[model samples]
Target chain A: MKRKHKRLTFVGLALLLLATAAALTLSAFEESIVFFQSPTDIVTKSVSPNKRYRLGGLVEEGSVRKKDDAVVTFRITDMANTVNVSYRGILPDLFREGQGVVTEGFFVSDVFTADEVLAKHDENYMPPEVADALKKSGKWNEMSSKMKKQGHVLGGGSQ
Target chain B: MLHRFANPTRFLRIASIAQPWIAWATILLAGTGLYLGLFNSPADYQQGESVRIMYVHVPAAWMAMFCYTSMAIAAGIGLIWKHPLADIAAKATAPVGACFTFLALFTGSLWGKPMWGTWWVWDARLTSMLVLLFLYLGYIALINAFDDPARGTKSSSILVLVGLINVPIIKFSVDWWNTLHQPASVLRMDGPSIDESMLWPLLLMALAFKTYYIWVLLVRIRAEIISNKIRILRLRQVHG
Candidate 1:
């Protein structure tokens, strides 16, 4: 009985330590999360112009412009709203108009000035956030149908 | 019902019959999955060929989470019901879970540098996953830290039950915080958000991983039981 009591105490102490550590770590991160926002989210929410964030969507058709050197500018849209993004780095090889793009940068004077740009290169792939942005803005049926026509089958999972 | 299968003789008989079938299924499914992933699947529109990494990465991530979950559940049974088999099963699962977690992180990093422009980020999702790997290592270490095997098992099982708090956090990390990691389309609402062509390979790989876990787990448990038997026999001979 004495040995069993000691084991119980040890278990309790371990639980206490784990709970403390988890609580501290979780609270520490509560203030420092970078959210991936959609174009519609940018338009509706007042994001600080200087704070860095990730913005994802399909590049608007015919909106990509190659400027001097490697710098380029484009408009990304969730079909409900669009945001302008400018980047100076060499774009990922897959960056193209009418494709899913996720950019990490800051807003300067309402323009998303991206430092990095990532494209969904799969001929059939759509980034989930971009898809959600379109769906939440109620343009999914129209756009998703068009995407489906491109031979992109919706992935299998529980609805 | 639990006690009925607690006998090692019964477990060995059942596992012997189940082993070959599970092993072959793993080969068949994983082989098919590799072929389709490497050849049949279309190059991603954006990431192009690099997206094929998901055939391995996503499944590994799933197995890492799956193994930890089953271990925790087993550990809980050991704690509450004092089931020796439960603890032994949990012990056997640790290294396997750790390997899967490591694969997830390694493959994810390889996928990341080309896709995210960086091999790693201190983002919530990535950091939480790294923590999970550490937790697995810690569990394995703690289990062996003690001289007495029972003490080691008891303490580690307690640690495991406590470590389980991380699972939900890992699953929701992307959603709860802003992250470079893509949000889950495969396990989320309104069905899979990704295309079906990619989804099939991912699912098959997941099944293959699960089968691989069971095959290895049975072998590990059998070895553990046999080692224990040898230890007991040696002790009896010495005392007599």
Candidate 2:
């Protein structure tokens, strides 16, 4: 082979090896790499209560209940299953009913007792006027249903 | 055909002509993009004014990945074909890519504080992007570590090629894992979810960033060529 062809083979071989190594490493750490588990994932896996993990899903509409001293309780749902979460302290500015969220804690009895709660916003972005117009035209519900059909993974998840 | 522009004199001539046009394009695109982003575009229904940060943050993030990919490709060409200009091009791209990565992280943090309620997280998307920033920095540091410039170039080119793996990982992190960061809005199988008004500023800003990279790369490559000449002259004088 020419010197250039020889160098090409070497680089190509190196890249192939590196890719294989990365694939193996990422697969090995797949479980840990997932930042949060959806309510459905939790239900199907029946995860142990002894371990702490992040629970993520949409905050179910009309499920938020504020208690005294900055404690709030809500239900996180994947549209297929729901998990009750109780969080203390302040919620993020983006936290709201019908919005995506992730709470970090372990299950206390049946409820998820969260120490850290984060809002996970979706990719959709539209002006307030457009949103209002969509609502007025009754297209908002259609769009929302379309999103639901796509899956309630929030930011695309392993599920 | 690949080495048609391998001659430094010919390359310099072309770069000199293209540089001013790229510089002006950057200024014009950036000015219009800022205007549209800050004023013309309406506030997001949910994020409100904070959504404007996307114009800067998203473009910077795109440019960061773009630069790294381009750098890796140039480095690979330099390694396989022994192209001096390719090596210079890869070297010139490093600091610019690093700056874009830093801007993405900084703007992301600012945006995150109000939206996500945190400055940072260890989520897969965010973590992989952070790793990209480190890879750029590591490549820069490695290239400068050796006294012998040729050795530095060879080693750093290998490093750049190896680091190319992170680009794909970063892009798919949100999809492969549950991340706090949202998935792609623009470069998705489905068309961009963003409204047309919001998307215009984003595209303009991304174009502006691309032109800025080209303008800077040309200047850096010219400087590198001159410096190489100076080094050669000094070595010849001393040896003679």
Candidate 3:
């Protein structure tokens, strides 16, 4: 009986300490916790400029600019609001105008200065993008109208 | 109250009855899941064929976290309530959870390279999940570190309790921190953001993984019980 009590006490103490440590660590890093924000989140929430973040949305059409070999500027949008993004690095091959993307960095004077850029989706298990495009142009109306009943836009075919 | 199942003979009898049923369910669910996931599912407007990786990758990721959470709970019960089968269940689950975590990380990387254009990133969701894999490895290693089986069980259970913090971190990482990984879509509060055509296969795959866990867990526990009998028999011969 005494041995059982001792074991229970030890287990109880360990759990309590673990809970305390986790709480402290979580509260200490509040800013680092906001992983990725939509453009509307940034505009509506008044995000601070100094904090690093991930900004994700559709890369705006006709907004991509290649000023130099490694430097690029573009705009990200959600069809509701848009945010300007600039980056100086080798862009991911999947990074293109008018696709979903995520950019990581801090804001610099109203511009999102991305340290890294990543495409939101990639071609792996699904059919190739070209096949999808071919299917879209041929049967877009029928497929989209079917999707419309479900109340959600088909991502790539939306625009 | 719980000592009713302390008898290995009784528990083994129950496990035998349940094992075959769980195994068959696993096969049936996986067959349907794969058919729906691979053949019937519509291609993602963005990801195309690469989106199919989610059928395997996401389910493995979910199982990795799930097994750890179950292990931690079993460890807590075994260590505190002194449940007989709980410790064996926890021990049996570690390797399976470790394997799932490894697959999740490997497949996630493979999918990432094609979609995100990088094989690796220090994103919170990915990194915390890596930490979970390490914790599973450490728990498995610690269990065998001691010459005394009871001592090893106690120490490993302690480690499992400490590592329980990682489970929540893994689940909320995409939401709590700036990560390259996308936020939750399937188990979201605002209903599933994924299209219904895609949601069916994902749910089926998740169910298949779950039934698979239950099937393997029973098999491992039975093995553990036999091993315990062997250990006891050897001790009796030495004493005699």
Candidate 4:
């Protein structure tokens, strides 16, 4: 009986140790967690200029400006506000004016510098985090109508 | 629960009756899910045709974690109560879980090249998911390493419980780690951020994958129970 008790206690302790270690590792990475902020939040919060974060909204129509080489400048808008973004890379084929886009980077003065950008390839798509941010901003209803019309605007092609 | 279901005759009787329905559901749901995900859903405006990968990748990823979690819970029951059925359940689940994890990684990589511009990255979520796959492989190997089935089950049960720690880590890795993977938007405290048009399909796919896992797991567990019975019966016939 004593031996059985000892074994049970050992196993219990081992499980506890593993759980604690994993929780610690998870919390340590918290600073790296990036949450999506709308153009309005970016404007109002005066978010730290260099801190890495995400900006998600529709690309303002007629705001895309292709610069020399791969460089491009555009504006992201949540209808409440807009932020300018400059990116230098091969843009995804789906990237266009007036489409949902999420970019990870931070603000530098008036320009929002993007290190990476996400472009959905389908009509029924949204980045899980970006969606949360939009719902929090009370702009999800506005986006839903736009998503329904996406098929009509994108040529109604399956590909 | 394990003791009541441990007897192979009892298990066989229950599983045999359920097997055909489980098989049919698996077939039906998988077909419907594939049709809707592939043919009906509209192509992403930005991703073009590649967005079709999401339907498969997301479902597979979800199953990978869900399978491991079920295995771990079975292991815990086995260890705490020495329940025979729990060990068998854990044994049956490991390979299936590993396969799902492998599929998730495979599909994620295929999707990543065009989207992230790289086939592999040390992004928190991706790396953690890879670790989960490795953990599943490790459990499978540990269980089969020994000649003695009881010894193998006992040792591997411990491993499964230890590996359970990784599940939460995987779920929160995107939130905690500064990695390329995006944070959670659909499962959140405030509410889902995605539009209903996109959210509904993803949710449907998620449910379809979950239901399919139960169907597959039940089938696999029944097979294991029958094999165990055959081994015991053969021993008795030879000795008699």
Candidate 5:
């Protein structure tokens, strides 16, 4: 082979090797790399209470209760299962009923004691006027149904 | 065909002609995009006025990845074909890509504070983007570390090729793993989930960022070519 062709072959082989290595490494660390686990994972896997992990899912509608102190209680659900979460600190600004949430803490007994809470917003973007109009026309359900068909439930729905 | 413009004189001539037009387009597009994103566009129903940050943040993120991909391709051509212009192009692209990466991170932090309740997170998407910025910085540092400029270009080209792996990783990080960062909205398998009212400003800003990169790239390439000429002239004078 010519010098140019030889160098091309060397680089091509190098890239292929590197890609395979990356793929393997990512797959191996897959469990740890995930930012949070859904309530379904915790329920089905029956994770031990000795270790701490993040629990993420939609905050169940009408489940938020604030006590006299800073403590707040809510239920996180992926529609298949629900985990009770008790948080003593302030929640993120975007935190609301039916919004996506991730809480990091320990699960002991039957409740999750959360030390931190982060809100996760959906990808949908629209003007408030449009949202208001949809609600007025009672077409909000139709819009949410469309989102469901696309495998995304923005708010107040099962995934 | 690539070799036709490999000559510095030809490259310079073409770049000179194209530079002013690109600069004007950048200015026009950025002005309109800013006006639409900041003033004309509607505030998001959920995020309120803060969603306007997406106009700048998303475009910066896209340009960061786009510039790195272009640099890697140019570096590859330089290595295999020994094209001097290609090497120069790759060298010129590093700092611009680094700046865009920084802008993305900075604007993202600003947007994340109120929205996500934190300035930064160790999620797959955010961490991969941070790695990209480091790759750019590492390339810049590696290129300048050598005493001989030719060796510098050769070694840095290899580094650029290696770092190309990070681009795809960054793009798919949100999907492959659970992340605090949201999944792709504009460039997903399904059409964009964003409404037309918000999508237009985003596209316009993205175009503006592209034109700005081309405008800066033309200037840097011209400077590199002129510097190379001066160096050759100095070498001849010393020998004579």
Candidate 6:
């Protein structure tokens, strides 16, 4: 019995150490994470124009327009506020209107110029930052309609 | 020929005979791969020196997936046939797969920082690969979770079999989703998009890693089987 107890305790301690290490690494990575901000937040906060940040929300219906071969402009709206964005190069297949996206870049001359854009493949999927932002705004359900339209069976029922 | 080595004693004998040959091949292939990667292969016109990471990252990723598939198949054999050695093979592969997954992720991140301009991206390919690493760790954890080794083996086998879905997901991620990660070049319907000079070394390194996996698996499984026999003997001695 004592021998078995010792082995069990050793295994338990090893697991605890492993879990702690994983958590520490995750937390460290989490701190560097910049949550996507909506245009509303950007407007209200008057965020520093030079600082790099991420903006995520739905690409507003009929807001995308091609400016040139190398430049394209669109609006990202959280349904309450919208920010104009300009991007260069070929867009991802999932970069359709009314889809959730996250872009990391900087604000230049009152316009958000994205250097990188991200879109999800699955229907119910929302970027982590977008989910957190909606939860904080108390409007995640209202926004999740987009998710529902995309066939998010699990998230659809919560609303 | 493959079935012949399914017997543990036969496997041990064959492995002992083949060990030196495989070891030499591994060394020669790896040495040549490194030399070609370092000196002969042309740098990407776009990516420059960072492209060297492809030599490591691609092989590690391939081996990570290969090891998991091998493990899951071994688990299946163990569950269905109650093959004594199959469970040992499955259990022995967990840490090796985990290490390969870690290497793939690590080399990928190093490559990503310069190429994609980020250390990490939640791109479909990247995310599913990350999930694979987690699955490997989960398998390792679950296998040791129970006091009864048999219980642990059975449960973890189920997990491994279920987690196999992530393999296809990783492979088709770029096609299924919009991701920063590039689509297949070497294994595509079209001929390899890569230059021949680079392709040869990468293929050789991949073979080297595969042989390395077989070598390590044999050594570890043999150790496990021996340890299990020792454990049974010790238990009998205690009871006697």
Give the root-mean-square deviation of each candidate in angstroms.
6.4, 1.4, 6.3, 8.0, 2.4, 13.5
Ranking by TM-score: 2, 5, 3, 1, 4, 6
Greater DockQ among 1 and 4 belongs to 1
Looking at candidate 6, what is the lDDT of residue B74?
88
Per-residue lDDT of model 4, residues A5-62, tens digit only: 7767888898898888867765665434333555766788767886886776668889
Please identify which of the two predictions, 1 or 2, would achieve the higher DockQ against the true structure: 2
* Best of the two (3, 5) by lDDT: 5
Looking at model 6, residue B162 earns an lDDT score of 72
Listed per model in order, the count of residue pairs whose N, CA or C atoms clash below 3 Å is 13, 0, 13, 12, 0, 0
Positional deviation of A110 in candidate 5, in angstroms? Answer: 1.1
Superposed by TM-score, candidate 5 places the C-alpha of residue B146 at a distance from the truth, in angstroms, of 0.7
Better of 4 and 6 by TM-score: 4
Tens-digit lDDT track for model 5 on B1-240? 887899899999999999999999999999999999999999999899999999999999999999999999999989988999999999999999999999999999999999989899898888989999999999999999998999999999999999899999999887677788887779988789787899999999999999999999999999999999998899999998
- Model 5 TM-score is 0.95
> Per-residue lDDT for B93-174 in model 2, tens only?
9999999999999999999999998999999888989999999999999999999999999999999999999999999888
Give one digit per residue, the lDDT tens place, for model 1 in B1-240.
988788888988898899999999999999999988898887654566888899999999999999999999888777766777888899999999999999999999999888766788776778889989999999999998998988999889877888888888788776565456666768865467667777888889899999999999999988888888998999999998
Query: Which candidate should be chosen as best, given TM-score against the real structure?
Result: 2
Candidate 3: regions farther than 4 A off: A1-13, A30-62, A66-72, A76-100, A103-116, A121-159
Residue B17 in model 6: shift from native, Å? Answer: 1.6
Docking class of 1: incorrect
Q: What is the TM-score of each candidate against the true structure?
A: 0.77, 0.97, 0.78, 0.70, 0.95, 0.65
Error of 3 at B41 (Å): 0.9
lDDT of 6 at B129: 89
Q: List the residue pairs that clash in candidate 5.
A: none
Candidate 6 residue-wise lDDT at A115: 85
Between prediction 5 and prediction 6, the one with superior lDDT is 5
Instruction: Supply the TM-score of chain A against the true chain A for every candidate structure.
Output: 0.58, 0.89, 0.61, 0.56, 0.85, 0.61
Error of 1 at B213 (Å): 0.5
